[model samples]
Structures are given as structure tokens and as C-alpha cells.
Target: MSHGQQTDSERKPQVTVVVVTYQSRNTIGATLDSLRESCDAGLAVVVVDNASNDGTADFVAAHAPWATLVRGQGNIGFGRGCNRGFDLVATPYVLLLNPDAVIAADALTRLLTFMEQNPQVGICGPAVQEPSGELQPTGALPDPWKIMLRPILPGWAERDMRHVVPGERPQATDWVCGSIMLLRWKMIEEIGRFDPRFFLYFEETDLCRRARRAGWEIWTVGEAVAEHVNAASAKATGAHMMWDTIAEHYFRSRFYYLIKHFGWPAAVTAELGELLLMTVRAAGERLRGRSYKSLGLRLRSPILKLPVFPD
Candidate 1:
């Protein structure tokens, strides 16, 4: 199969690109355009639009008619939305891409070749760089203790505590960021789709952890590079304005991840650390004449009541 050419069988797409979009009208076009560069490689594209009021769906329909658009009923978070898109893929390989990320013209081809050469590797991601060309730390495994201590500890100390370090050479990792994940179909069949319990954050970490536990190797292909507009969709949704809400989701997901993998003790310790951090933040905000009520409430909310997770 070559770039932009449809397979004769037509029943099997070699690669399926799944992009989940939410209020991404401004960036989705460029993302689709970049994917078009690799369409000849027996590629199938699916765009799952999470009920964007901004006509993001309509924009995709008009701009990239080649992509099958799944119109969501409401704002399903990234993981769930990706699962929805996955339901439509029959390809052997699926690439979970972000609407604000653009891969190099040959990026998909390089990733496919790498995966073909290494059958044991189930999931792989490219070197993610910001639009300004700075490398993004998308290849780190989640460290509960480090995450809990990040706010209180210095950056150097936390760096030392982390297990995976991003490097130029291709290497195995605990998890790759969800931004541009290329996953083998067999792995998904074995381990299952992403956990819906995680709405926004830590979902990818959970997926990678599960994959690793299932004996699948996660890798980073340095040759395959992507430029991501970091947090573009989140910013569009006013995530910047609702710092408390964002922090709430992050901490809730973090607690759930820790509890599931490490145990209740770890989760409890993490929650306490977060509570202390939020209390100090709220106090400072109040002293500075800023609204601190939401932060205080986040600190007080029961850990079990956090969104989308079971007790």
C-alpha cells in the first residue's frame, strides 16, 4: 500500500486515525490537512466531535469530507470520545491523535514501519513538540509519589524520582501521552479500551499501565515527530478560567489511578497532600482578594465523590 491509495480489499484498512475533537474549530482543519499527507498509506480517518457548540463538526464535514465524522451527543471527555471513535475502526493499527496536533507528512509511514519491524511492541508514540518546536514531556510514566510531591518539592528532586526520561533514541517507556498514540489492534483486543472513569486527565496513564501489565511493550519512535498545540481545546473551553475545576478533575483522576494501582494507602496519602496544597493556595488567594471558595470546596470534597469513578 502506498500513500493515499485505497486497498484493493477495501475491507481492511491498514491504519485508522482516530481524532477526538471538542470546540476545536480553529485547529482541526490543519490536523486533517496533515493527515491527508499520509492518506495514500491505506489510511482511514475518523473524527469524533464531542458536541462542540462552535460548529466544529460542521467545519470538519465541509473541510475534510474524507473523514468519517461521529457527532457526539454531548461533551464526552477525551478518553470516552476516543473509545467512541475506536468503535468504528476495523484497521489493524489505530492512531489516536489530537485535533490540535499535526504529524509530519511521513510520520505515520515511519510509525507503521517501526511497528511492523517490532511485532512485540503494542503501543508507540512520536516525539511530541510544541508549536514553537520545544520538546514536550509526553513520554513519562506516572509516578504517584512524584506527582504528590511536585508542588512541594523542587523540580530537580522530582526529576530524579521519575522512572522514564525522554531521550532522542527510541526506547521503552511506562506510558506515552495520549496526544499521538499508535496502538496495535491486538493490544486493544487483549487489554480493552481506555477506562471511561477518567474523563480528562490520567486516562492515558491508566491505559499504558494496563497495557504494560498485559505484557505489551510501549515505545517511543523518535523518528516520528508531531507538533502539538498544547491545551488548545481545553483553553477554548475556558479551562484557563476554571483553574479550580481543572485541578479538581486532575486530583480526582490521580487519586483513582493511585487507588487502582497502588492501593488505598497511596491514594489517601496523595489526597492529603493535595488537600494541604489546595488549602495553602486558597488561603493565599483569599489574602490576595481573589475568590477562594471553589478551591476551598475542592479541598473539602470527599475523594469518593469525585466525577466518573466508582467507590
Candidate 2:
């Protein structure tokens, strides 16, 4: 098996997987289990635990003995955990997969094969789907000025499949969700790793943008698919309080992303827009005599089950 290591005579895996998990006890096993085919082909995998208190590390250690597990002192956050795992790898290609995501059969092989055949491509992502065979929403790269309209018209953000044609080959993409993305080692050596400052969201987008800026093509392979149980780690935390819920992290990360790429003034405007949108959404819900989440999911900020706070 490609366990991230091989003797001189043994064939090595061209790609390694890095999975960062936090409070993912409910879904980590399925994610690992889904890699059976890839693991058999010598695809070494590294699993990082960002201080999961739910015994997630123990489960990975005891259950997935083949995977190299990195336990954290505390919740180092997703980006940092992925960086830690990436530092330990030397494979030509690396995949950063979410603990809540499960790839379809041979999905890793296809993604790795695609990256190997297309050396110009630095980062590639699978077409995300739900376990029930539904196409999950993945967004195109955010436009600095255009994203401001997201608060008013949610669909202003670009769709993930905008560049894709159903029966065609892998197409160029601005960015893909961090849920299941493959990276080139050389790309990292050239452009650096995921921005550690981004605790969770937008870190992958930052990495993708950097790669694009470095003359590396970002792509999405429709043929390579994965089932993402979107935000299972965050849901596992069972945080309901506004400050404790993933919304806090999600919004804070969103703000940082806006400021880093755009500017502080733009980021502030976006935040205020979010507030206005949320208030409008609340008013609509009142008229409907029903409840809806605050500033609900968008192609730009597709958060699942945020539960409208104080629920």
C-alpha cells in the first residue's frame, strides 16, 4: 500500500492526502473509509486533528492505523493544521480534504491522474455532490466589487459550474471549495502554503488565488467527484450560541478574506451590507410567519445550518 513511504524498489504514490479534522467524530471515519481504493494504490494520507475533544484523534489512531495522524495541543485551526500536515509531505501532489467529505470510488486516482498529466495545473478540485446524488453548490472565485451585490441579489455570485460543460473535460476554474482539492508540491514551494491567519473559511480560496497569480492554472474536474457532508465538523461542535457557533468563525474568516484581498474599507462595507441583508431577511420571515437563517447561504458565503442564531 502507498502509505506515504516506500522502499527504493517499491513504487511510491505520486499524491498524498492531508485531512484536517476538528470535532469531526461523526464523519471522519467515513471520509477515511472512502479512500480505500486510493490507499491500496500507495496513496499515503496524513490526518491532522485540531484538538478534537470528541476523541476523534483516538478514533483515527485506533481505526485508521495506516494513516499518519498528527494530534494538536489545542485547536490550531483548519489552515494551520493543514499546513502542519503539508510540511510533513514530499509527494509531488497533495490533496487537502475535509473530514466531512467522502470521495467517490477512484476519485483520488482520477484527480491525481489529472494533475499528473497536466503539469501546468497547480490546484484541482472535484465536483462536489451530496451522498444522495445531488450536485452540491460550489462557488466561483469571488469578485472584489461584484461580491458587494451578494447582499442584495444572492445569485450575483458566480456558480461553480459556470465554466463546466457536462460532457467535456476538466475546465479552468478560479477557485474550488476547500472540501476536496488537490495541490502541487512545486506550487507550494513557489507560492507558500495556506494562509495560517485564515482560521477556516477562505483559506483555500486564498491558496487558489495565490497559485493563479503564480502562473499555475486552477481547475475543476467534473469527472472526479466527492460527496461532501458540508460542515460536518462545525455541526459536530453543537454550538448554538451566536459567539460559539461556526457563524462567528465563518463571518470573521469572510471579513479577513475581504480585507486581505480588497481593503479594510471594502471589508467594512461588506460587513454592514451583511447586517442590512440579515435585517431584510428577518423582515421577510416575519411576513411569512416562519423562521429562516440570518443572511443565509450564498454562493459567496454558503454556510449550512447556521440556524439563524439563538435557536
Candidate 3:
């Protein structure tokens, strides 16, 4: 062997951080700045702008020339834009970061170290912190029952019933939120990437489900942390639209996820339950003289319009 040659163990694993942006001008700068602080020489960054006209692409080009920017893809939705960015990753690790989330200085390094030690872990996520420093519920398996009961039950009652809480121990989870995730390239080779059918929500859940089914572990490293300004870009986009487009998108994704995973019967029952719950809530709101525009809009979402089971 040559004197200067290095073995695979001696070589640091490279990572590519993929951020999908859409009108995320305000938050993208902070996110990039934090990434710069967290990343080492082995780290590369890619920003895929979904035809954002709010100077998001321009800002990335000017301020973050080190990052590879892919623009003019015309709002291809989160999952698809992420897939496009994934196509550009040449690293062993791919970190999918939300445009509004900022990793702590040692967060990326910690995640990488953990993954290196545990080859069986295919997907790992950091403990997400809200701007207030409170822990967000980033690590949880999808609970179809809780999701269904949420609309009908009081918040405190639901919390009591489910004992829903975040933990500080690094452990396996069903799925972590997509706000910040570190994925193994080998796992991608085996299970592929996020399902393009999911335009926004539930895509991460779907991906994690597939990975678990394929015998890879999904874990959340509680010690590694990131601060996320949740849904900043989505809120910005929704500002231009009426009738809570975000909620509608969520319902559509939920229906697709349920049908894809649990089959037609489960999806239909859940959809009907959701419709009934929303209708009751709307009536109660009206009786109290409160506006129920958002509830009404959700009740009429396209998910409800679709046949309970697709042909």
C-alpha cells in the first residue's frame, strides 16, 4: 500500500443535505447559515426551488454559491422536489432538511457518528426543538386511531388517553417527521425514495414504513438537536390562498396514505369518521355563533368528493 493511501474506515463519510424550497426566502437564509455552521468538508448542500418567485433562488445563488441550486421546477411538491434533489446526491448519507429548520452545530456530526456505529439504522432523525426551545413531537409512529379521534376529542382528553409525549432517549421509532432526517444511501438503494404520490404530508411516514418492512431500523437520536420554524414556507404559500389549503392537502395525503397502507376498507372508514367528526364540530361551532369556514372547507375537501374506494 502507498504511504499516503487511506482505507475506507479512515475516510470520512460524505453527506449531502437536500433542502426543498418554495417561497422560503425569509427562512432559507437562516437554514443555510446553520448548515454552514454544522457541516464539515465532507458535507455538500443542494437547494431545489419549486419555482419560487420570491427571490428564494436568487438568494441561494448569491449568498450560498457553495450550494448547488436547481430552479425552475414549478412547485413540484415537497416529496417530488426532494426526489429531484436526491438524484444529485453523491454522498453515502443524504440529509433531508426543511427550509425552515436549522441544525445545531454538532447535530449533523452526532447523527453521522451514530449511523456509522449502527449500520442497521437506515433512517435517523434529530430531536426537533421549537423556537421556544420546547421539544416538538418529531419521533412517533403513525397512530391511525389517534389521528381519527383528534378531531372529535378535546385536546387534553386526547393527550390523556394516548399519553402522547416526547422522550429524550435514543430509540427506534416507526417514523420520524421529515423536518430533519438523515438517510442511509444503502437503504435508498434497497427501498428507493419518498413516494412521489405524496405531494406534501405523510410522505415520510410512507418512506419509513417501507424501510421498516424491508428490515431496516428507523431511529431518532434524542441528543442531536435542531430548531425548526414549523411550516413557515407552507404558511407563506397558504397566505395567498383561501379556505385553508393546507388542511385540504393534509386530508388528501392522509386518505392516500391510509389507502396505500391499510387498504380500501380502512381508508373508507377513516374518511367517513373524519367527515362525521368535522360535521359535528361545525354544527357545534355554528350553535355557539362562531365561524366554521375552515371546518366547512375541510368537510368538502376533494378527498371527500372521491369515491370511498378508488376503482
Candidate 4:
């Protein structure tokens, strides 16, 4: 690197990275190390451990003592944990990263530079790939009808299509994957932080939805790349053993997201529509000589039990 380039790099905007962990002992270290390489100066990392019995907090305390660790009172969930870490950040830019995601030093700097250059963009993300190097969905906000159709329709019907990577180019998008997002502090201050009601899923969606409504543009820079281990924390945690409980949280959060934005009528309609679609799918499977094993799981979700308005 030339001396001029090194001096220019030192002038890049400061960034604060917030990583919320839940039984993420297996993955958090690599994530922290990646962040360390992501910047030589002007970076603060906050790790909020949500009562991980797996010694995730202790590991952070012992190994990455340079990071600011906040031990949560309990398993307060992802959004709440991020909020806890966010409170400690005073930088102009904030990066919310998953405990199992990795971004190269150049990629992190590219994202920071992108945001700095495009002042209109409130949030930006890199082109993300799975651990296997397969390109993941850039980003797409799901359609309510498609979410309701699920098994009754094609496989892609309910899949997340929220945002996308621009293929070695930069483009404006509505939102980006929450796994690794670079956010402008001013935009967050104007639109507020992640909604705490979302214990797990849909929190970032909710925040991005608000960002769009607040007239903030979200972008995805394809030149920057990130690797994400999908659901690493969720799978490693006891949540995998306690899937039913986890499913309930997901369904309830989904329901709350639907109702909060689209209102009660849409949610009620969606719940009934989904049940109807599942029934149709089950009948079709039975006629085709296959048993629909997921019927019981869907029924057990108890999405109807969630309130339209917070009680």
C-alpha cells in the first residue's frame, strides 16, 4: 500500500460493531477476530451474551478482553441483546453482525466507505454467501400472500427474497440481510433502533421497514462480500432441542410483525388462509400417497394465541 493510501485509510469513518450471542461459543471467536482485522483503528466491538450456559460470555471475557462485553441478565433474545450492546456504542456508524458471520478487512472498509460517500443511504450490506460459498438471497421483503401460501405453492413462495447483492456493482435496495448490515447512526437515531418486541425473527425486517418509511435509502454493495453461517446460533443453542418453543417464538413474532404493520385484519386473514392452504396441501399429499407430517407442527404453532395488539 502506498503511504498516501495508508493515510487516506486512517481517515475512514469510525465504526462500532454489535454482535449478540446465544450459545455461540463455537462461532463468536472467529467473528471477533474478523472484526479485529477489519480495521486498524476507529472500531469498537460490543458482544452481548444472552445468558449462554455454553460459556460464550466467559470466552469473550477471557480471550477477546479488548471487546466490551455485556452479560445479559438472561436469554433476553437477539434484538434485546443487540439493543443492550447498542447502548454502549457512540460511533457514527454501527455494524450489526451475526455471531457466525465473517467479513474481510477490505469488505468492511468498503462498506464503511460506501456509506460515507452515499449520504442518502441509511443502511447497506455486502453480497453474502453461505459457508459453502453459494450466493445467498441479496434481500427481499416477503409478500404476505406468499408467506400464507407456503406448502400449497412452490418452494420459493415463502422463502425470504428481501434484498440482493448487485453482482460486483452497487445498487439501491429497500433492505439487506440482517446477518451483516452497516447502519448510519443518524438514520437509526431518526427511525429508532430494532424493535424489542421481536424476540428473534423479523426484528431487522421491522427496523428496515421503518427506515424505508422514514425516507432512508438502503443499499447493497456487491464488491464487498461476507460469509454467513445461517442460523448458527439458533441451531447450536438448546433452541434446536427445544424447537417447539422456538417455533412458537417465531410464529408469535411473525404474527406480531404482520399485525403491527398490516393491522389485525390482515393477520387474522393470513392465519386462516394459511390453515386453509395447509389443509389443501395435506389433502393433495394424501391423494398422491404421501402423508403430510408437518400438519401437526403447523397446528401447534398457536399463532392465533398471539394478540393483535400488545396486551
Candidate 5:
């Protein structure tokens, strides 16, 4: 048989890695290079650039010609861009990777092997570390308890808090991070695709919740890993204010999620608590640094008009 043509038993199951880029010209190359080096699994790629004026599409075309590139007509936001990439890929498994993350050589292999062994696991995510090799709290179940505590605790602490014990059989979750997430074709068919209502944040959480309701299991693979240059796009794109705006959307989505899952009373209380907690937490962070005064002006500059508590 030809090298490309293997017996059914010998063939590796295919996985298409979908990366959505929005003005990620500098970092996308590194992300693609990592995939090339580490991905031995049957590999395909789809790069969807969301109306980036930074020549992100041209950069991908030149540097990663192997990838199928799609230049979006306008900024369609994160979920939509990813869905577009997902549509273009023709693999049994779809790996939704961020433009800032680089996969470990065995990451895809490990994730796929686990999913195959555990047929109930419709979606899986790998442990993500920072470029400096520290664990970046990437994936966790969105428990009501965790969400409440998140504002009080530090980022690392919030991330490390697993809602359920690890190594237990597959279970449902509110959502997992979009970074380095793996999804089976079956799950997509059953649960439906990501809801594009969210322009950026909480998009994954909303999708996972729907998947769980549909009886799909979300899995976290502790062994598989990736290095995520965390939040590079957010910083590079000068969307620091956009971060807060998206955060408001996240809280709004939480209210929406509560209404969808629970009811109105719960959503109302949840929204109030979230608003108060978020405001306090942002204040606390400013206090910890000596730049509270400077941070005030920055907070005021966003287009979304987030109210700053009188400091």
C-alpha cells in the first residue's frame, strides 16, 4: 500500500485544527509553527481572519500555505469566526485552537486517544500553560459556587479550582475555554454549534451548557498540554476597553443563562451580585497596585461606559 494509504487499523483518525485570527499577525505564525512541529495526527487547518487590516490573511497564506485561509468580510466576532472555520474543515475531530497557543507535539494524539477510549466524552480540552511554563487556569466547570468566588480570588486560584474531582467519569459542565478545545463531529450534530449571540466572552460556556443539556459529556485531559501566550490578541489589538465591554456581555449572558436554565428571580439576583462583586474586585486590584489613580482614567475611557465606583 502507498505510504498515504494505510489499512483501516493502521490509519490515524483525522483532526482539523481551526484557528481564528483577528489582527493576530505577529503571533499566529508561532501558533501555526507549533502545530506543524507537534501535530502528527492526520492534520488539516482552517484559518479564518476577521476583517483584520493588519494583513493577517496574507501572513497566513505566505507562511502557512498548508492552511485553508478565509478572510471574513467584516469583524464577525470570535464565535462566528470559529464557526466559519469549523464549516471549512472536513475532519472527524475539530480542534478549536487560539492564535496565541502552541500545542505540545503529543497534545492532539493524547486528546484523540482519550476520546476514543472514552466514547462518552464528546468534547475534551488540554491543560494550558503560560509561555513562561506556569499553568494558565484554562478549563473548569462553571459552578455557581466558583463563579461567585471568582471575583474575590486571584486568577490562578480561580482557574485551579475544579468544580468536580478530577479522574471521575465524564460529566456535564457549564463550559470549557475555547483555547485548545477538541470537539467530536457527533457532539456538534447533537448539541448544535456555538451560539453567536456572544461577540467574545462566555461563548464557550454557553455552548457547553447546551451540550450538557443534550446529554454530551465534557472532558478535561490533564495529561495533554499547550502553551498559550495568554491574551496576546486582547493586548495587541488595543481592545483593553473591549475586554470590559465583553465582560459586561459575559455578565449579561450569565443573566441570560440563568433565565434559560433556572428562571427570572435567580437571574436577577445573580446579575446584581455579579455587578457588585465585579466592581469591588476591580477596585481591589487597583488598590494592590500603586496605580489606582491612573487606572481610574483608563477605566473611564472605554466606549461601553462602564460605571466606575467613586474612588
Candidate 6:
């Protein structure tokens, strides 16, 4: 590189990356390598291991001695683990990353530049793709109906359709993919921490929802890219069982959100409809020879609760 170019590169803003891992020994190294290539020497990388028996901590320390490893007290879940790492970060901006995700070489700088260009944006997320480079839905405007209808209805019907398309163009979105979200320190300070009530799912949407309500814009930096190994952490434990629990938690959290904002009647209505839909799907899947065990059924009893609100 030319001297002027090298000097300009050296003047880039410093970033602190916080990666939360749970049984990710197989994929963490690749993530670290990608981050190393994307980041400068001054970047502070914090890896919080959620008590993995796979020797994740030692492996990380030995491989990347510069990284600060925080061994989790237990599997405190994703949002909580990220919060733990966030406490240690004092940088102007922080990147919340998953161990199974890899950011492009220019992702950090591009995202940082985008945030710099748009002072109104408090949180920015990059375009996300699967390991195969297929575009993933990285940003969406959060709404109860939109979240519930995405699976039942076609893409055109949903209010947040931009996410379903693949591109490298910036756009305003309700929420960005938590797997690779970048937040300015000022926003994090003003909004407080992520709602730990969402042990696993919906935490990102909740935070982004709050950010939007607080008059901050959330943007998707389409030029920035990250390859995410979807559900890497959830799959580590037990895909079916873990996902079921996450779904239940999501439903409950949804109800909790409704109750807090819209009152109890709405919360009850939302909860009942969610439970009924879950039961029907579970029953259908079980009849397909998927096995009761695969459906989180230990002898045909339902794994979740289902009852009308008054009951």
C-alpha cells in the first residue's frame, strides 16, 4: 500500500468486539481468525464462554492470547452473556458477535463509517448470509403481527419485506441480526442493557424495538457482510428440545411485552393463540414419524402449556 493510504488506514477508529460462545470449539477459531483479519492491532476482543466442557476457554486463550476470556458462571444464555461482556467494554463502539459468525474484512470499518455518516443511527447491523453466502434476513421492523405472520403468509404481505431480498444497499430496518450487531456506546448507555428476561430468543427484537421507540434510527449497512452459522449455539445443546424451550420462552416473553405495554387482555389473547398454534404443529410433526422424542415429548404428554386465558 502507498504511504498515504497506510496512514489513513492507521487512523481508523478502534473497536471492541464481544463474542459470546457456548460449546463452539469447532467454529470459534475461524471466527477469531476472521476478526483478526478485519480488525486492527488495537481492537479489544472479549470472548465470554458459557461454561463449555469442551475446553473453550483454554483453547481461546492459547490461540489468541490477546483476547480476554470470561468464563461464564453457567450457560446464562446469549443476551445475558453479551451483557456480561458489554460491562467490560469501554470503547466508543461495541460489536456483539456470535462464535459461529465471520465478518468480512471491511465489515468493521464500513459499519463504523456508516454510523459516523449517520449520527441519528444508534445501532447498525450488517447484511448477513449463511455459511454458503445465501442472504439471510438481517433486519426487520418488529411488530407482533409481522413476526407471527412471516411464516403463515407470503413475503409481499409482510411490512418488512426488504430483509427477504438479497442486496448491498442501505435501508432503514426495525431490528438487525443480533449475531453481528454494532452499537454506539452512547446508545447503549441511554437505552440500558438488553432485557435478560428473554433468556435466548427475541432479545434483539426487544432491544431494537426499544431503540426505535426512544427516537433512534436503526440502519442496515448492506455493504458490511457477515457469514453466520445459524443456531450454532442452540444446536449444540439439543436442537429440537432447545428450540422448543426457546419458542416457549419467546411466547412468554411476547406475552410479557404485551402485558407491560398493552395490558393483560392483549397479553392473554396473544398467549392463547401462540399456544394453540404450537400444539397443532407439534401434533402434526409427531404423526409424521419424526418420533415423540424428537418433538420433546417424553411419552406423549405435551411439552408446553395450552389453555384459554380465563382458565
- What's the lDDT for all of these models? 0.79, 0.75, 0.78, 0.80, 0.69, 0.72
lDDT of 1: 0.79
- Name the best candidate (by TM-score): 4
- Return whichever of 4 and 5 wins on TM-score: 4
| Cα lDDT tens digits for candidate 5, 169-279 | 444444567877899888887787777665666678777777777877887776776777766546567655335435554445555555666566665555455445667
TM-score-superior candidate, 4 or 6:
4
| Superposed Cα deviation of residue 258, candidate 1 (Å) | 1.4
Worst 10 residues of 6 by lDDT: 302-311
The TM-score obtained by model 4 is 0.87
lDDT at position 150, candidate 2:
57
**Ordered list by lDDT, greatest first:** 4, 1, 3, 2, 6, 5
**lDDT (Cα, tens digit) per residue for candidate 3, span 35-59:** 7754554478999999999999999
Candidate 5 residue spans exceeding 4 A from truth = 1-13, 37-41, 138-140, 143-160, 163-174, 233-249, 276-311
- Candidates 2 and 6: which is better by lDDT? 2
Ranking according to TM-score, highest score first: 4, 3, 1, 2, 6, 5
What TM-score would candidate 6 get against the native? 0.78
Give the runs in model 4 whose Cα sits over 4 Å from its true position: 1-13, 155-167, 232-245, 307-311
Residues 150-254 of candidate 1: C-alpha lDDT, one tens digit per residue:
544547334532222234667787777788889999999999998998888889899998998999998888877788887654556755523534666776677
* Better model by lDDT: candidate 1 vs candidate 6: 1
Model 4 lDDT, residue 79, Cα? 81
CA RMSD for every model? 4.9, 6.2, 4.6, 4.0, 6.3, 5.9
The list of candidate 1 runs beyond 4 A from truth reads: 1-12, 160-167, 233-245, 274-305, 309-311
lDDT, model 5, position 104? 62
